[model samples]
Target: MFKWASYFLCSFAVLASKGSWATLQDNNQTVCILKDAPNQCGSFCLSALDPMQTNLDAIERKQGVITSQLWALISRQDVQQKSLPSLDYELRRHTEMQEKHISHLLAVQSEMQALQKEMLHSILDVYKKLNAHQTLVQESLDKSITKEVFENRLEGVDKQLLTIGSTMAILMSRSVDQPHTVQNQSLQSPQASLQESLSEIGSEPPQFEQIGSRHFFIEHNLRLNWTMAAQRCRQIGGHLASFQNRLEFNAVTAKLLTGDVYYWIGMNDLGQEGQFVSVASGNPVAFFDWGYGEPDNLGGNHDCVDIAHAKMWDSKCADEERFICQSDNEV
Candidate 1:
């Protein structure tokens, strides 16, 4: 019996080491309750409990390692939760800043548009004023031109009337002096006799003096302004006398009587100051016969040329003087 107990103890010890002690306890519990098998069965049950206790201790250590890992995971999750509100606040601030920038840009655009509209209005107003001023200037210039034309026409009419009155006065004076002589001469048809009497009493034709290729007529009895002298010359199919050289000037001056009177020549500086030109040919005066600093453009108004004592001098165009006319006999 001692040898069997020793063998059972050794076997139980081997099973406990192998970790199968709980199965052995369930199978041998009824045997351990018998009085005859109490000591050996209790010993066997105690040996089996030892292996179960060791197995329970190893399982508890593995559970403690798993709980520690779960706690670490919970701590990380809490930290992430704590940061969420700060991140949300930063995002909201950025959005508000962007909205304010957009509002400022819109306001600047509106102000620029308003300034541009005001500038356009100011420019339009200036343009209207300039247009009105230009219209007024044009109207004033047109009225001035019309008045000048009317005055010139009236002057021409008055000159013609004066010429006709002078001719009628001369004819009436001749008729009063020779009334019986005019009646005796009208024995033929009244129209033929009247025509003959008119031809006899009319002004005589102008006598011309020939020099070179030109014919000249000196009107010593007529004293007129430069403009009127030129007109009278044109009436006789001639222009104001113009000399080409000193010889022709001397010849013309020799024909005139020496006195205090001056005769108008064709040269004038009316076109431009200091540039004497011939009124007949519209050419610069190549021949200068100025008498001792006489053409100093006296008083800045002496624009006409005159001959005095065979020398040329500048004179006012309004001065009334006798003038000579010349015709191109070659034509």
Candidate 2:
């Protein structure tokens, strides 16, 4: 189509130069045909350009629509691009928080484990002490007698002495009136004969071991429950022994026992689960020698205390044991 327009314009320029049909002028920007004579060239050129003008206007309107759509697409892309940084920030923040929470949880778990391990060790230590003392206690009990039997034996001996002393006294009084020479004989008085007989028997009452102005005793030949032992001590004008210091505890404990055995002390928590008091003084114990993890109160029945190997342990109150009696009275 452009070739046809060019061919017609060139032909019109040639026809105007050669014939008296039209005048042609070049204004540098466009070609113009002067209608000096009534010429059809200019009119044909105008008619040709009119159709192309309409097509150009439609193309311009289409270009404007495309430009508007392109701008809208760019705007949407800009909005999406602007949101990425904030999304990344939120993701990073959540990750950091989660990491911190995990770290804290791990730390707490470690602490709990440490505490549990320590507790287990403490329990094991207590159990070892308990087992050792229990075995010794059992052995001691096997070699011991009940307090009642021991007392009965002593009472019988006393009765025998009383009768013998009376008989000797009567016989000596009669011999004194007769006046017979007794040579190389030492039986002169009833008290002397009684003492000689007692010496021959080689029996003496249980004596307390004393240290630092304190007297305490435990008969290895006696086995009694905690309550009975305490009652027996009271009957003997004393109470179950309580220690004021380590020196007194050690001194009395070392000498008062003939063999290894757990001995009941005055210390007990019968009135309260965790509070120990001495029955002798009825006050809180002034000293303590509790073994590791002691007073665990196994079975919740261990309100009494036993002293063994210089350490205190909780024991069942009803269990029989050897016990020391303490008396502050001067002998």
lDDT of 2 by residue, 257-329 (tens): 5445788878899898899998898888888888889989999899999887778899998988888888852
Which pairs clash (backbone N, Cα, C closer than 3 Å) in model 1? none
Q: Worst lDDT window (10 residues) for model 2?
A: 175-184
Per-residue lDDT of 195-311 in model 1, one digit per residue for the tens? 344334324546678976567988887788897777556545677878887777777788887977799877898989989887777788768788898888888889999888888
Work out the TM-score per prediction.
Answer: 0.39, 0.38
Colliding residue pairs in candidate 2: none
- What's the C-alpha lDDT at position 103 in model 2? 100
Backbone clashes (count) for model 2: 0
